[model samples]
Target chain A: MAMSQATAAGPRRNRVLNGILVNGTLALICLLWLVPLLGLLVSSFRERSDITTSGWWTVFPHKSYISAKQDQLTKGLALDKPIQVEGVSLTDDQLRAGYTLPDGRKLIWANRRARIVDVQTSQWTTKANFTTANYQAVVLGQTYTYKQSDGSTKTEVGEDMSKAFINSLTVAIPATVIPILLAAFAAYAFAWMRFPGRRPLFAMVVGLLVVPSQVALIPLLRAFSNLHVNGTYLSLWLVHTGFGLSLAIYLLYNYISGLPREILESAFIDGASPFTIFLRLILPLSVPALASFAIFQFMWVWNDYLYALIFLGSTPDTQVLTIKLANLIGSRGQDWHLLTAGAFISMILPLVVFFSLQRYFVRGLLAGSVKG
Target chain B: MIHQTRDAENKRASSAATSGWIPGQFFAGLLGVVVVIALLWAGFIYLRAARSASILNAIVAIIWGVGGIGALFYVSNTLIEALPQKSRDRIRPFLFFGPGVVILFLFLTIPTLITLYQSFFNNDTTRFVGLSNYIATFTDRSMLESFRNNLIWLFLGTGFCVSFGLLIAVLADRSKFESLAKAIIFMPMAISLVGASVIWRFMYAYAPADQPQIGVLNAVLTSLGLQPQSWLTLQPWNNLFLVAVLIWGSTGFAMVLFSAALKGVPGDLLEAARVDGATEVQTFFAIIIPYIQGTILTVTTTTAIGTLKIFDQVFVMTGGQYGTEVVGTEFYRQFFTNRNFGYGAAIAIVLFIAISPVLVYNLRQLQKQEGF
Candidate 1:
C-alpha cells in the first residue's frame, strides 16, 4: 500500500508540474502580447509631457512623492525672511541648495526656483496620470495658442479624425455588403445550378484567391485615372468588392453546397421557381455563412491601406482611417500622445466587431482555411 | 421518388419555355429595374454632395449602399423571371454571376494582364524595355536590399508567428483562463497594421542616454544599467525589430487556426497513447503534430504569403528607411514615388512569381479535395 501510494503521488505531482509549466508559458506570452497594446492605451490617456518624459507603465499608483513648484509655495511671501513650507523652516543656504521636509519629504532648489517634494505616499493616486485630452484632440480637433518670438499669439488647429471615421464607414459598409450580396448569388449558382462553364469558372475563382493584389495596383490606378474615379469612395468600394469576391464566393459555396438537398428538392416539387427558392430557402438557411463572410470582408476593407492609398487619394476628405492613421504616423512621428489616441480610435470599431461577433469571425476563418 | 419529382420539374420547366412571354410582367420588371437605377443614381449624387463628415451623411450612405443593392438584386431577379423560360434559364445564372465576374475580370484579371504588359514598357510607356525591367528588379541596389529584407521578413516573421501561435494554442488548450488568454493574444488581429505600427513605435520609442526613456523596452534596458539604444535604427537588427511588429500582430491569427486544429485532434487517440505508457510529450509529437499537419501547412503558407506582401508595418514604422525595405514598399516607391512604372511592374511580377508556387499548391489542394 505504501509503494502504490508513493507511485500515485509521484505521477500526480508530475501532472501538476506539467500543468503549471503549460499555464505559465501561456500566461507569459499573453502578457507579452498585451503589453504593447496596453502601453499604447495607457499612453493615449496621458499628458503629452508625461508621455515624452516617462514610460506609460509608470502611471500606476506607487509609493512616490509629489513635487510642487517653488512659486506655488512662496506665493505672496517675503523671500528675505526664513521661508516655512509645510511646517518646515528652511535656512537660506538650505533653501538655495536643498532641505528635507519635516514629514519625510525633500525640498530642493534648482534652476533658481524652489521646489517642495511632498512626503512619500502623499501623492500615490493614479488619477493625475490620465487625461482624455488626447482623444478629444484626435476626434474633435484641438486648438493651441502659441506666443510667437515677436510677442504675438498664433492659434493653430489640429487634424480632426471625424471625417476619416465617416469615410471609413462609407467605404467599408458598401464594400462589405456588395461583395456578400454578389458572392451569395454566385455561390448559389455554383453550388446548385447546372451551368455549362460552372466548374471552370469556380476554378478560376479558386486560382484567383492567391493572386497577389500588388499586381493589380499600378494598372488599376491608371485605369481609375482614365475613368476619372480615382479619388472617389465608389472606386474603393468596387475595388474591395472585386478583390474580396473570390474568398467570399469560396466560403459561401462551401457552406451553401453542404446544405441537405432534401429541402431544395421538396421545394422544386412544390413548383417553386429557382429565384424564389434561392430567396426564400437558400438565403435564410445560409445566414451563418453570409455573416461570417460579412465580418471577414468588413474587417479586410476597414484595415486596408494600400488600396485606399492608391485608389482613394490621401486627401483628408477621402482618406480612410488606415490612411489617416498612417499619415499621422508620418506627420506626428514624435507625438506619441496624438499617435496613441489616433491608433486607438482607428482600432475601436474593428475591435468591437471582433469581440462581439467573434464566434462568426472564427467560424469564417476556419471555413476559409480548413476545408474537409 | 426523387427521380420522378425531378422529371416532373423538368417537364414543367420545359412547358413554361413553350409559353409566350407576358408583356405586363416584363414591363413591370423593367420599371422596377429603372426605379432601382434611379434610386442608386440619386443616392450616389447625395453621397457625393454630402462630403462633409456628418452623422446624417453616414446614415444616408449606409442605407443607400445596403438597401439600394438589395433593391438592384431583387429587381434584376424579377426581370429575369419575366423573360421567356428558355431565355430565362440561360440568363438566370448570369444575373447572379455577372456582376462578380465582371468586377473580377475588370479589377483582377484584366489588370493583372495589363500589369504584365506594362512590365515590358519604359517608365512612361513611351518605349519598350523588354527584360531590362526584370533585370533591374534582380540587380538594382535597393531592389536587392528589398529582396534580402523580404526574405528575412518571410522566414523570421512567419517562423515566429507559427511557432508562438502553436505554442500558445497548445498551452492554452483546456487551461483555466483559456478564453481570456486567447482573447488577449488575438486582440491584435483586429487592429489595423498602421495602428499596430504606432503601438510598436511606442514600445520601441527612444531618447538620449541621459533623458528618461519613455519607450518601455529602453526604460527596462536603462534601469538595468545598459545604454539606451535606438531600436528601429539599430542596423540589420532593426529589420528583426520590424519583423517583431509583424509577429506581434499576426501570431494571434495563426494561434486561432492552430487552436481549432488542435481541438479537432481526437481525445481517444491521446487516451490510447497514454494507456500504452507513452509520455505526454511523446504523444503530442507523434500523434497531435501529425494529426494537425494540414492545418500547420495552411497556417504556414498563409502567414508566409502575408509576410511576403508585408507593407503597412514597414511603410508606417520605418518608411523603408534604415534598410528595412521590403517588396511591397519597393513596389510603392518605384510605382508612385519615382514613377518607374516598368520597374514597379517588374517588382510586382516578381512578387507574383514568388507567390505562384503557393498559389499552385493551394489550387492543387482544392482539386485533390474535390477528387476525394
Candidate 2:
C-alpha cells in the first residue's frame, strides 16, 4: 500500500529522472525527424547566389559581409587579383591613380615604378550576401522566354510547379477516387457474397495483388490500342483503376468483413435495398477503411511517375505532377531548390490528407493489427 | 408417397431450409448462381457482338441477346423473390456483392489467366513457343541482376523498415506530443512514392567535372571539412540507398499501426507494474508489450508484403539502375522494355510465389481476428 501510494502520489526523484530520459529521447527523435525537411525548406528559400555564398544554416541571422572593389584599385589589394582580403582591402594604385589622401600632397609609390594591373584573382567567400531570388524565380518569372509588355520577346520563365501541381490534382483525384470507389464495391462483394466461384474470385483478386502491374502493361496497351482509348485521362484512370483495384479491394475486404454483421442485417430488415443499405449503413461506417485506402491510393496515384510516364507520357499536357517534377530533376533531379519546393507542393495534398484523416489511419491500423 | 415427397423437396429447394435461417442462405446461393449465369451471358453476348453476326441486325442481335437477356433474368428473379422471406435473406448481401464479383472476374481474373497463356508465347504474343521466354529470363544479364536485387530488396528492405518502424513507434508512445510526433513520421507517408524518389534523387545529386558539388550532403561534407562522395553512383550500396526510400515511405504506416496497438495496451497494467516497483522501462517491456505483440506481427507482415511488391519507386528513380532492380520493376522491364511476355509473366509468377506465404500469413492473421 505504501509503495503503491508513493509511486502514485509523488515521485519527485523518479519523475525528474524519467522525465529527463523520455524528454531527451523525444527531442532527439523530433530533431532527427525534422532534419531532412528542414534541410529542404531552408534550401528552398535560398537564392542561387546565397546558396553559392553560404550554407542554408548561415542564411538566417548572421550579417557577415563579402566586399570587393575592382573600381578602387588594380594591384596590391586582390579585389579581382590575388593577395589581400578579409573586408577592406588597400591598394597603392588607388592612392596614386585617383583620389587625394588626407595629407595635402597627392600620394604615390617611390616613383611610377610599379605598373598598374587589373585586379584579377580567385575570389571565394562564405558570407551573408543572400537574397530571395530563388523564390522570385519560382513565383512570378524566370530567365525563360515569354511575350513582353510591348509585344516583343522576353524571357520571363515562371515556376512550372503551379501548372504541374494542378495537372497532378486533375489526374490524381480521379485516379485515386475511381479505383477506390470501384474497389470498395468489389471488396464488399468479395467479403460478404457467396457466388459459384467466390473463393476463386477472391483468390484471383489476392493473386493479382502479387501479380506486378507491369505484367499487364503490354496486354493493356494492346487492349487500349484495339479499343482506341489511349492517350487520355480516361485511359490513365482506367490503368490506375485496374492496377489499384486488387489491393484496394483486398484492403477494404479486410475491414468490410469485420463490421458487425447485425448492423447490415438490421438495415436489410428495415426494407432498405442493397444500394440504400450500402450508402446509409456500409459507406458511412466504412469511412475509416475507405479513407485509409483513399490515402494509400491518393499517395500512390499522386506519386506515380511510372503509370503517368508510360501511359500519359505520349503528350506533355497529360503529364502528372510526379512526371513533371521528375523531369525537372534534370532527368537526374540535381536542381536542389526547385526539388525542395516542388516536393513541398507535391506533398501538400497528402499531408492534408494524413493530418485530416489521421484519426482514421490510426483506427484503420489498429483494426488491421488487433483484428487480423 | 413419392409424388408428395418430391413436392416437399421442391418447395424446400426453392428457399433456404426447413428452418427460417436457412431460407436466407438458400436464397443467397440461388442469387449468386443467377448473377454468375447472367454475367457469363453478357460475355457470351459481347463475344457474339462481332460486327459480322448477321450483318444488318448485328446491333439488334447484340443488344437482344446479351444485356437484354441478362437484365431479364435479374429483374424477373428480383420481382419473383420480392417476398424477402427466410433462406433468401442472403440474397441481399449477394445483391450487394454481385456486381463486384463480375467486374473482378472480367478485369482481374481474365487478364491473369490470359497472362499465363501469353507467358508461353513469342515476343508479340502471337505464336506459342513454350518455355522459351522463361528460359531467357534466367539467362539475361539484366534479368539476373533484377532477380538478385529483388531478393535483396525483399529480405533486407522489408526487414529494416518494419524493425525501425516498430522501434520508433515504441519510442513515440505516451509522449506529450504524440500526435505531433506521429504526424512528423506520418508526413512522409503522404508523398507519392515517386515524389519521394524524386526528392531523394536531389539528396543524392552529384556534380562533378569542374563543378563544385552543390548537393546538400556534399555541401555539408565540404562545410565539415571533408571530401565529397558520389552516393548514388556507388553500386551494390546504392540499391540499399534506393531501398531507403521504400523504407521511408512505409515506416509511417508501420508506426501508425503500432501506435494504435500501443494505445490499446491498457494503462492500468503499466500502472500496476510501476506500483510493483518495476522501473518505467521494465514496466513498458513487461506490461505494455505483451498486449500489443499481435499488432507488431501484423505490421511486420503488412510491410513485408508491401515491400515485396515495390515497383513504382525503383522504376521512377533509378529505372532500376545502380543494381536497384526489384521483381515488380523487373517484370515490367522484361514485358515492356525487352518485349518478352513469357519472361515477364514468369517473373510475376516468381513474385507471386514469393509473396504467397506472406499473403497466407496475413490472411490467416486476419481470419484469426475475425474468427472465420
Candidate 3:
C-alpha cells in the first residue's frame, strides 16, 4: 500500500509528459502538412516575376536586386561618356551598376542581365506588392505575346478554366446521377428481391471493384469510336457510370441490405408490390446512403483526368478543369503564378463539396475501408 | 337482374380509379425519357459539329444527363405498372437490375475481353504476335526503369501514408484541436492529384545558384550554404520526389480511417492497462495497436493499391522524364503518345495482374467483416 501510494505521483507526472509530447508532435505535423498547400495559396496571389524570383514565403516586403560583373562593364562602357543611373551620374567607367559606395545611395540595375550600356540601372528598394492579377488573367483569358523559336512574336490566348468548369459540370452531373440511379436499383434488387444469381452477381460486382481501369481504356475507346461517340461528354458519362457501378452497387447494397428486414417483409405481406416498395419505402430511407455515394461519385468524376484526357480531348470547349490545369502545366510550367491560380481554381468545387458534405464523405470512406 | 346491376356498379367504381392515374403516369414517364434521349443525341452531334466552347451544349448535356437517367428509371416503373399484374411481378427485378448490368457488361466486361485479345496482337493490332508484346514490356530498358519506379512508389508511398496516418491519428486522439488538425491535413485529399503535383512542384522548384532560388527545397538548401539540386532531374531521387506527392495526397485518407479505428479502440482496455502499471508507450503498442491491427492492414493495402495505380502526379510533374516513369504513365505514353497499342495493352495487363492478389485479399477481408 505504501509503494502504490508513492508511485501515484510518478504516474501523474508521466501522464503530463505524454500529453505534451503527443499534442506537441501533432501540432507540429499539422503545421508542416499545411506548408505545401500554403505555398500554392500564397504563390497564387503573387506576381509572376515575384514567383520566379523568390519563395512564396518571402512574398511580403520583397526586395529587388541587380548584380553587375566586371567583364560586362569593360565590353560595353563608352570612354568619356556620362551614364545616367537612377538619376545619379556615373562618370567613372569602372564603377558599373549595383555598386554600394560609402554613401546612403545604393546603385542597382535593371532586373534582367544585359550589356552595360543597355543595362539601365535603378535604386534598390523594397516593395510590398501583391496582386490578384494572375487570377484575373486566368479567369479572363490573357492574350500572351511570346517570341517564337523562329524569332517571330506570336499572340495566343492562355489556357483558362472558365469554360472547362462548365465542361466538368456537364461530365460530372450525369456521371454522378447515372451511376447512383443504376446502383440504387441494383442494390434494391440485391437486397430485397428474390433472384437465383444474387450471390454470384454480387461477387462479380466486388471483383469488378478492383479491376484496373487501364485494362478497360483502350477497348472502351475503340468501342466508343465504333459507336460513334468518341470525344463526346456522353461517352464519358457512360464510361464513368460503368466504371463506378461496381463500387456504387457494393456500397449501396451494404447500406440497403442492412435496413430492417421486418419492415420490408411486412410491406411485402401487405400486398405492396416490389416496384411500389422500392419507389415509396426504400428510396426515402436510402437517402443518406444515396447522398453519400452521390458525393463520392461526384468528387471522383470531377477530379478524373484519364477518362477526360482520352474521351474529351483537350479542345477548349470540351476540356474539364483538371485537363485544363494539366495542359497549363505542360505548356507553360514556368508561369508559377498562373499555374498555382489555375490549380486553386480547379480545386475550388471539390473543396466546397468536400467541406459541405464531409459527413457523407467520411461515411462513404468508412464504408469502403472498414467494411473492406 | 338486380345482382347483375350491383356487380356492374362495383366494377365501374374500381376501373374509374385506375383509369385516372395509370395512363397519366405512363405518358409523362415516356415523354420525359424520350426527351432526355433526344437531348443527349442532339448534344453529342452539337459537340462534334460545332465548337466545344458553346455554353448551350454544356447546359443541354447536363440537363439530358441528369434528367435522362432518372427518366429511364421512371419509364421502367411506369411500364411495369401499365403491364398486367402477373407480368409486372415477373419483370420487376429486371427493371431494377437490368440497366446497371447491361452497362457494366458492355463497357467493363466487353472492353476487358477486347483488350486481352489485343494484347496478343501487334502495334496496329493486325498481326497476331502472341506474347512478344509482353516480352518487350519486361525486357525494355525504359520498361524496366518504369517497373523499378513503380515499386519505389508502391513501397515509399504506401509506407509513409499508413505510418504517418497512424501516427497522426494516435497523437491527435482526444486532443482539443483534433478536428481542426485533421481538417487541415485532410484538405489535400479534396484536391486532385494534378493539383497536388502543382503544389509540390513549387516546393521542389530550382534555379541556378547565381539566380534567386524560388523552389522551397532549393531555397532552404541554398540558405544553408548547400548547392541547390535539380530535384526532379536527379535520378532515383526524382522517383522518390514523385512518390512524395502521392504520399501527401493519400495520407489524409489513411489518417481519417485510422482515426476512426482509433476511436473504436476499447477505452476500458487502456484504463485496465494503466491500472496494471503499464506505461503509456507500452499500453499504446500493446493494447491500442493490436486492437487496430486490422485497420492498419486495411489502410496499408488501400494505399498500396492507390500507389500502384498512381498516374496524375507523375504525368503532371515529371512526364516520366529523368528516370521517373511508372506503369500508369508508361501505359499512357505507349498507348497515346507512342501509339504502341500492343505494348500499352501489355503494360496495362501487367498492372491488372499485380492488383489481383491484393483485390482477392481485400475481398476476403470485406467478406469477413460483413459476415456474408
Candidate 4:
C-alpha cells in the first residue's frame, strides 16, 4: 500500500528506486536475520577439526587445507622439492595439517591432531562432506579418543544431553500441564463467577505477573534445599507451575470472560452445577487460550536456564538441556560442531511447536501483551 | 437477527436471575479443597519416601501431579454435589481459585518476601548486617559493572528489537512474500536463549590470525584483510555482543506484534492522508506510527524488562567473563557459584526494584485495555 502510494506520488525514477530499496532492504534484513542460524546449521554437519579450522562458509569453496610451517622439522630434512601430501604442497619445513584429499578424503593425524587437506579444488563440486558425527557425539554421549603424551590413546566420554533431555521433559511436561489445569479452572471462576473479593484478587494476580523470577530464586532455593526437593523434578515442576500461574490465569481469564454467557446460563438452567459448566462447557470452548498458554509455558520451562541451573544445579544426573548446553559452551567452547548440534537438539522440539502452532503462539503474545 | 435476539435474551435472563446466596455446601467444598491438597502432599511425600528417585519415579510423580490434581478437582466437585444448590454456587469459586492462588503465594510471593528479608543479612544469613549487602551491590566493582551492562542491555536491546521490528513490519507488509519472509525472520524466537548464544558464538567465533577464522564476523573481517578479533572476550564491547543475541530473538516477537498492529491501522486513513497530498514518509510517521503507539510501548516495556534480567547469553557465551556481567548472571554467580547468599539476595531485590516501575506501567496498560 505504501509502495503504491509512492508510485502514485513520486517521480517514475524515484519509484523504481523505492521498489529496489524496499525489496532489497527486506531481503537483506531477512538474510541478516538468518545468518546466525545458517552458521549453526552449517557448523553442525562439519567435522570437529573442520569446524575449528575455518568458517562454515568456506565449506562451499572447499579449500580445506590448514598450512602451518614448523622450522624444527627442516633441520634434518634433505628433500629439495616441496613435500606433496594429498595434493597439498608444503615446503619440507612446513607442516601441512588438517587437509582434505583430492578425492574428498580427509587425512587425520592421530598424534598431531591435524587435518590434511588438498586446498586445490577448482571445479564447483556438487557434493559436500556433511557428517552427523557431532549430533551423534552429543545425543549418544560418544567418546573421543585422544592420544596421551606417552603415545597411548585414551577415550573420554563426551558430555551427552540424553539424560538431561529426559530430565527436561520430566520437568517441562508436568510443569506445563498442571499450571494449565489450575489456571483454566481459576480463569473460569474469575471470568464468570460472582464472588466476594474477586476483583481485588484478580488484580493481585495481575500485579504478581511482573514480579521478576530473580527475587524468588534465592528464597525458593533455600526453602527447597530445606525440603530436600531442590534438585528434584518435583521442585522444578512445582516452581514452573507457580511462575507460570499469573499469566496463565490472566490470558485464560481474558478469553473465557469473552465467551458467550448464554452457554453457561443455559447449562445452569439445565441443572448442571457450576463445576460441570466449567468442566464440560468452559474448558471445551477455551481450548485456544488453553493451548496458547500451554505452548508459552512449555517453551518457557524448556528454554529456562537460570531456574534449572539454580534449582536443579549442574549435576550430571539432574541437569536440564539448558544447563547442559551452557556447560557444553563452557567446557568445550571451541567445539563448534558439538555446540551447534547440541543447540539444534535443544531447539528442535520448541521449533516444531512454534512452527506448527505459530498462529496460537502469536495470538498468545498479543493477548498476553497488548490487548488482553 | 440471531445476534439481536441473543442480546435481548442475555439482558432479560441476567435481569431475571435471582440474587445469589451462600449455602452450607460452601463449607463442605472448602473443606474438600484442603483435604485434597493434604492428600496430594501426602501422596507426593509417600512417593518420595518409597525410594530414591529414578526415571520411573519421575514419571510416576509426573503422573501423580497431573492426574492427582485432575482427580482432586473431580473429587471436590463430587463433594460439593452433596451441598445445597445455592451453597455449591458460592463454594465452586473457592475450589476453582484455590490451587493456583495457593501455589503462587507459596512459590512466588512468599519467596519474594523471604528474599527481601534475607537481603539485609550476612552471607550465611545468621548475622544481621542491615544495608551492608545493599551497599555492596552499589559499591562493588563487578556489581557496578553488572548494573552498567544491564542499562546498556535495556536500552540497546530494546531499541534494536523495537526499531528493527517496526522496520521489518512496515517493509514486509503487503509484499508478495510477506508471510514467508516474516516466518524466516520469526524463526529465532523459537530458539532458547542458550541456543541463540551458541549460534551467535559461532558467528563471533575467532581463531588467531594464523588460523582461518571460523566465526562469521571474524571471518568477514579476516576476508576483508582486517585482524581477527575475539568478539566475546573484548572488554566492554562484549556486553553489546551478548545484547545482540537477545535482540536477535526479540525482534521477531516485536515484529509479529507490530505487524498485527499495522493491520489494525485503517486503510481509509492512509487513503485520506494521501488524498491530502501527504508523502509516504509523512503518512507513516504521522498516521501509522501514532496508530501503533500502544503496541510499541507494550513491546518496548516488556522487552526492556526482559533485557534487565538478561542472563543466559552472558552466561553461555562468556560466563560473565570479559566484563559482560548482567544482574541475573551476577545473582547466579554470587548465590550458587560464590556461595554468597546475602549478596545474591540483594542483587535479586535490586533487580526487583528496577522492574517494579515497568510492572506498574504494564498493569496500568492492562487496566486501560480492560476499559476500566
Against the true structure, what is model 4's DockQ? 0.47
Pairs clashing in candidate 3?
A: none
Give the clash count for each candidate.
0, 19, 0, 9
lDDT of 2 by residue, B101-184 (tens): 555555556666677778788767778888877787778787788777877777787787777776777777756777777788
lDDT string, candidate 2, A57-130, tens digits? 56455433222223333333333332232233346446345333343223323222343323223234344444
Per-residue lDDT for A242-355 in model 3, tens only?
Answer: 999998998998899899989988766655556657767888999998998889889899899888999878877688898999988888888887899999998999999999
All models: lDDT? 0.83, 0.62, 0.79, 0.80
Q: Which stretches of model 4 miss by more than 4 angstroms?
A: A1-17, A61-127, A144-156, B1-35, B46-59, B84-88, B366-372
TM-score of each: 0.88, 0.74, 0.84, 0.85
lDDT of 3: 0.79
> Candidate 3 — number of clashing residue pairs?
0
As for DockQ, the candidate ahead, 2 or 3, is: 3
Candidate with maximal DockQ = 1
Give the chain A TM-score for each candidate. 0.82, 0.71, 0.79, 0.78
Q: Candidate 1, which CAPRI tier?
A: medium
Which 10 successive residues of model 3 chain B have the least lDDT summed?
B5-14
Candidate 4, A97-208: lDDT as tens digits: 4445557554433222233323343344322568877777889988765445465876666668888788788778778887888898888888877788787778778878
Worst 10 residues of 2 chain A by lDDT: A104-113
Better of 3 and 4 by DockQ: 4
Which parts of model 1 are misplaced by more than 4 Å?
Answer: A1-3, A63-109, A112-128, A144-156, B1-87
